[model samples]
Target: MKNLKIDREKVLLGVAGPVLALVVAFLLTALVLIVSGYNPFEPFELMFGAIGEQDVQVLIINQTGVYYLAALAVAIGFRMNLFNIGVDGQYRLAAMLSAVVGAHFSPPGFLHIVLIVVTAMLVGSFWAGIAGVLKVTRGVNEVVSTIMLNYIATSLIAWLTLKDQFGYQAEGSNDLTTGEISKSGWFPGIHVSDLAGDIYGFIFVAAGVGVVYWYVLTRTRFGFDLRASGASESAAAASGVDSKRMVLTAMLASGAVAGLAGMPVLLGQTHTYSQSFPTGVGFTGITIALLGRNSPVGIAFAALLMAFIEKSASQLSYATPPYPPEIADIMKGLIVLSVVISYELVRRYGLKRQQSRVGRELAAQAAKNRKEVSA
Candidate 1:
C-alpha cells in the first residue's frame, strides 16, 4: 500500500507539472494583456469562435503534421545523446533537393510526388552523414558543427533559388522560391467536405511514424545500444557498444526524420521549397523533445498538445484580441520549463526515496538476523 501510494504520487506529480505550468503561464499572459488595455475575455471568445468547422480541418492537418515529424526528428538524436541541431538544415536541403529532383524527372501523377519525397529522404540522410563523419573522425562536436552547417545550408539554398538552371525565382521577379511543383506532384488532401478538404493523409502518416518510432526505440536491439550510448559512453563502450558508429548512424536517422518533416510543408502543403522553407521548425524540435521527455509516444502527445494550443490560438485570432492568440508560444515555453524543472526535482526525489527504502529494508534485515541469532 505504501509503495503504491508513493508510485501514485510520482505519477500524479509527473502529470501535474505540465498542467500547472500551462495554467499559470496563460493567467500571467492574460494579466499582461489586461494591463495593455485589451479585454482578454473578448480575444478568448474570438479565438474559440474562429475554430469554425473549416478552420478546424486545416488546423489539424498543418499544425499536427509539423509537430509529429519535428518532434520525432529531435527525439532520435536525443535518444543517442547527440544534439542534432541541424534539423533546419537537414529539412531545408532535403526539401529543396527533392523539389529539384522532382522537377528534373517529371514522372506521371502520384509517382512524381513519391519520387520527390524519396529523394528528400536520401538527400537529408546524406547531408546528415556529413556531421556524423565529422563527429566520428575529427572529433568535432556535433552541436557546434551542426549549427554551422545550418548557416551553410541556408546560404546554399538561397543561392540555388537565384542561380540559372537552379533558379526558383518567380517569373520576371526576384522572389525567392522555386517553380511550383507539377500539379500531379502534390499530395491531395483528404476530402472532409465539398467546401473543405482536410489533409487527413498526413495525420495517418504521423500515426504510422509514431508507431514505427516507438517500435524502433523500445523493441529493437539497435534501440538498446542507442539508449546505452546516451546514458554513458564509457559504460556502453565497455559493453562492446560502438559509441562512435551509433552516434553517426543515429544522426543520419535523425536527419532522415527531419527531412520527412519537410514533406508536410513541401509536398502536402506548398508542393515546393521556397526561401521561407525553413521556419522555426528545428528550434521547435527542442521544445517538443523536452516536453515529450524524448519518448516517441510522449513526443506524439506533447506535439499534439502544442499543435492544439497553436491552432486554437490562431483560430481565436479571428474574434479575440491578439493577446489570447499570441499566448500559444508563451504557453509552450512555460510548459517546457515546468517539465524540465519538475523532471529534475522528481528524479532527485525518487532517488532519495529509493535510498531511504533500501536503507530501511537493510536495517530491518539486520534486526531480524540479530533476533534469530539471539534466540
Candidate 2:
C-alpha cells in the first residue's frame, strides 16, 4: 500500500494541479451547457445512476485495461522526453500481422499465445524503430516521423487486408476479419453472467506490463541513463551516456508496449483484426498519459476515469427525452485544455519558488558570517 502521507511538493505538483484543472473544466462545461440551453445536472444525474450497473462496470474495467496499456506505451517514450505519436500505427499494424501469424500456426496453447505476443512486439518495435533510426542518423524529429508513419500504416494495412493471402475475402463476411482463430489461441475470460460481459483475462497481462514499466523505469541503470539523457543530452554525453542509443531503445520499448495495447481485443474478444476492430486507442493513450502525468498509478486511475466518463455519458442519449451526447466530448476537451494550462502555470511557480528560497538562503548565510567577523 502507498503511504498515506504525501509531501507538499508532491501534493502541489501531482494533486493540486489535476484537482484544480478538473474543477475548472467542470465549471466551464456547466457554463457551456447553460449557454447552449440544456440542464447539465440532469445528464450528470442520469449518468451517475447508470454508471454503477454491472454491464457499465465491466465496460469501464475492460476499456481501462486497454487504455492503461496504451498509456504505459506512451509513458515509456515520455520518460525519455520522446514523443511517439505512432502508437496508433504501431498497435494496428502489430495486431494485424500478429492475427495473421496466429491464424496460420498451430502450436501448443500457451506457446501459441506466446508466439502471437512476440509477433506483435516485433512488428511494433520494427515499425517504431524506423522513426528512431531516422532521428538518430538523420536528425529527424520523432513527432513528424511518427505522424507520417501513422498515415503510412493506415494505407499499408488497407493494401495488405485487400490481398487474398492475408485473409480478405467477400465484403459481406461475418466481419472484415481473417479466418477465425482456433479456441486454443483465445485467452480465457473471467465469466460473470449474461448481464455483464466477462472481464478479459488479459487484464492480468496489462497489470503485469504496468508493474514492469514502473520497475524498469525506476530501478534499472538503463532507466537512469534514459532519464538523464532526456534531462540534458550534453550533460549525459559528458558523463559517457550514449544519448543516441537511449533514444533508439526508448522508442523500441514504446512500440513494443504499444503492440500489447490491442491484444486484449484480439486474444480476449474479437480473435481477429478487422475493419471493425478498435481504432484511435493509440491517440487516446496520449491523452491519458498526459492526464496521468506519466505515472503508472496515476495513469491507471485516469484510464478508469476516462472509461467511466465515456461509458456513463453515453447513456444520456437514452434518457426519457434525451440529452445531447456531444456534451461528453466537450467535457473531455475542456478537461485536457485546463489540465495543460494548469500544469504550465504550476511549473513556473515552482521554479520561481525554488529561486526565491535559494536567494534567501545565500543572503542569510553571508550576513551570518559578517556578524561573526564583527564579533
Candidate 3:
C-alpha cells in the first residue's frame, strides 16, 4: 500500500509539472508582452480564432508530425547522454543525398519511396556515427563532436549543392538543386479538402517511428542496456554491458531518426533538395524534446503545442491588432525554461521526501521488532 501510494504520487507529479510549467510559461510570456507594449491577450485570441479554421488545423497537424520526428531524433541521443546537436547536419545531408539518389533512380513506386527513406536513414546514421566513433575511440565528448559535425555538414552541403557537383542549376533559374524526384518517389499525401492542404503522407511514418521507439525502449534488452548506460557508464560496464557499443547504437538510432526530419518536405511537398529547403528544425526539435521530458506521449503533446504556437503566430500577421511573430519565440523559450526549472524543483523535493519516508518506515519497523522481542 505504501509503495502503491508512492507510485500514485509520482504519477501526480508527472501530470502536475507539465500543467504548472505551461501556466508559468504563459504568465511569464504575458509579462514580457506587456513590457514590450504588445497586448498579450489579443495574440492568444487570434491564435484561438485561427485554430478554428480548417486550413490552419491541417497545417498544425502536418507540422506536428514533422516536429515529432525531429524531437524523437533528439530524444534518442539524449537518452544515452549523447547530445546530438548535429541532427541539423544529419537530416540535411541525408535529405540531399537521398534526393540525389531518388533523382538518379527510376524504380517502381513503393520500392522507390522506400529506397529514398532508407538512403536518408543510412546517411544520417553514418554522419552521426562519426561523432560516436570520436567519443568512444578518442575520448572526445559527444556534444563537442556533434557540434563540430554540424558545421562540417553545413559546409559539405554547400559544396555538394553547387553546380557540377551532385546538384545542377535549374532551367532559367539560378537555384541549384538535385531536381524533382519522380512521381514514383513521392509519398502520397492524404487529401482532406479543397480548402485545406493534404496531410503529410509521412505522418504515419512518424507515428510508426514513435511506436517502435516506445516498444523497443520499454520492451527490449537493447533498451535496457541503453538506459543502464545512460544512468551510469561505469556501473553499466561493471554489470557487463558494453558501453562503447551502446554509444554507437544510440548515436546510430538517433541520426537515423534525425534523417526523417527532412522527409515531410522531401517526399511530401518539395520533391527536391535545394538551398531553400527548411533548416534549423533540428534545433527546434531539441527544445521540443526537452519540453516533452523525452517521453513519446510528452513529445507528441509538445510537438502539437509547438506547431500551434508557430502556425498561430504566423496567423497573427492578419489579426486585427497585428502582434509580431517574435512573440511566439518568446513563448517557446519561456515554456522550455519553465519546464526545466519546475521539473528540477520537483525532483529535489521528491527525492528528499522519499528519503524521509524511507527513514520513518525503517524506524517504525525497528520499534515494532524491539517491542515484540521485549514482550
Candidate 4:
C-alpha cells in the first residue's frame, strides 16, 4: 500500500507541472486577447475545430515527425549540458549536401535513400563537431561557438546554393535548388485519402529515433556517464567519466539527429533543397525540448502539441473576425514562460513534501523507541 501510494504521488507530481503550465498559459493568452479587443476563446474554439479535419490531422502528423526529430536532437545536447544552437545551420547544410548527393545518385532499391540519410548525418555531425572541438580545446562556450557557426553555415549555404554553384534555377521557377533527386531517391509515403494527402514515411524513422534515445539514456552506461557529467562535472570526473569526451559525443549525436530533421520533408515532399528550405526549426526544437523536460515520451507529446497549434493557427486568418496568425506565436511564448516557472514551483513543492514525509517518519520511529524503552 505504501509503495503504491508513493508511486501514485510520483505520477501525479510528474504530470502536475505541465498541466499547471498549460492552464496558466491558456488563461494568460485569453487575457492578452481580451486586452487586444479580440475573442481569445473564439480562436481556441476554431483551433479545436480544426483538429477534426482530416487534412489538418495529416499535416499535424507530418509536422510532428519533423519537430520530434529536432527536439530529440536538442534533448541529446541537454543531456550533456551542451547548448547546440547551431542545429539550424547543421541540418540545413546537411540537407543541402545530402540533396546534392541524392540528385547525383541513381542507386537501385533503398540504397539511394540510405545514402542520402547517411550523407546528412555525417555532414551534420561534422558541422556540430567543430563547436564541440572549440569548447573542449579552447574553453569556448558551446553557445557562443554554435551561434557563430550558425552564421557561417548560413553564409556558406547561400554561396553554395547560388545558381552558378551546386544549385540550379529551373526554367520557370525563381527559387534556386540543388536539383531534384531522381524518382528512385524519393521517399515513399503512406497515402491516407484524397482529401488528407500522404503521411511522411519518415515518421517511422522518427519513432525509431525516439525509442533509441530512451533506451540509450535510461539503460546504457554511456547515458549514465553523460547524465552524471551534466549533473556535476567534478563529481562525474571523480567517478571516472571523461567530461570532455562526453561533451563531444553528445554534440555529435545531437547533430546527427538534427541532420535527419530535414530529411522527411526533403525526401517525402520537396525532393530537393532550395533557397526556401525551412529555417529556425532548430530554435523551435529548443523550446520543445524544454517543454518536454528532455524525456523522449514527454518530447513526443510536446512536439505533437506544437505541431497541432501551428497547423490549427493557419485557420485564424480565414475566421469571421480574422485573428492574426501571430497569436499562436504569442501563445507558444507564454507556454514556454509558464513551463519554466511552473516546473520550478513544482520542484520546490515536491522537495518540501518529501522532506516533511521523512521528518514524520523519523519522529514516529523516535516515539516508538521511547515507548518500547518505557515498557
Winning model by TM-score: 4
Residue-wise C-alpha lDDT for candidate 1, range 1-375, written one tens digit per residue: 988988897777666655555566667667766787877566556555656668565765577777788788888998898888898888888888888776668888778877987888888788788999999999999899989989998888878877675766666875666677877887776766665556646566767887888888899999999999999999999999999999999988988888888887777667667776657787777787777778766677777777767767765556422455456776667777766776777677777987998899999999999999999
Candidate 3 lDDT tens digits, 75-145? 99888988889898998999999999999997986999999999999999999999999988998998889
**Tens-digit lDDT track for model 2 on 1-375?**
233432566576677677777888888988998898888678878878887688988888899999999989999999899999999999999999999888889698688889998999999999999999999999999999999999999988877777565765556665456656777889898987798978988889999999998888889998889889988999999999999999999999999999999899899898888888889889889888988998899899888877877888879988777888888788878888988998888788877877997899899999999999999
Tell me each candidate's RMSD, in Å, in order: 2.9, 2.6, 1.4, 1.2
Tens digits of per-residue lDDT for model 4 on 240-318?
9999999999999999999999999999999999878888889889889988889999999999998999999988998
Better of 2 and 4 by lDDT: 4
**Residues forming the 10-long window of minimal summed lDDT in candidate 4:** 275-284
Clashes of 2: 0
- TM-score of each model, in listed order: 0.88, 0.94, 0.96, 0.97
Question: Clashing residue pairs in candidate 1, if any?
Answer: 43-320, 43-321, 46-319, 46-320, 47-316, 168-177, 168-178
Clashes of each: 7, 0, 0, 0
Distance from true location, Cα of 340 in model 1, Å: 2.2
Regions of candidate 2 where Cα sits further than 4 Å from its true position: 1-6, 168-174
What C-alpha lDDT, on a 0 to 100 scale, does residue 119 get in candidate 2? 95
Local accuracy by lDDT, each model: 0.77, 0.87, 0.90, 0.93
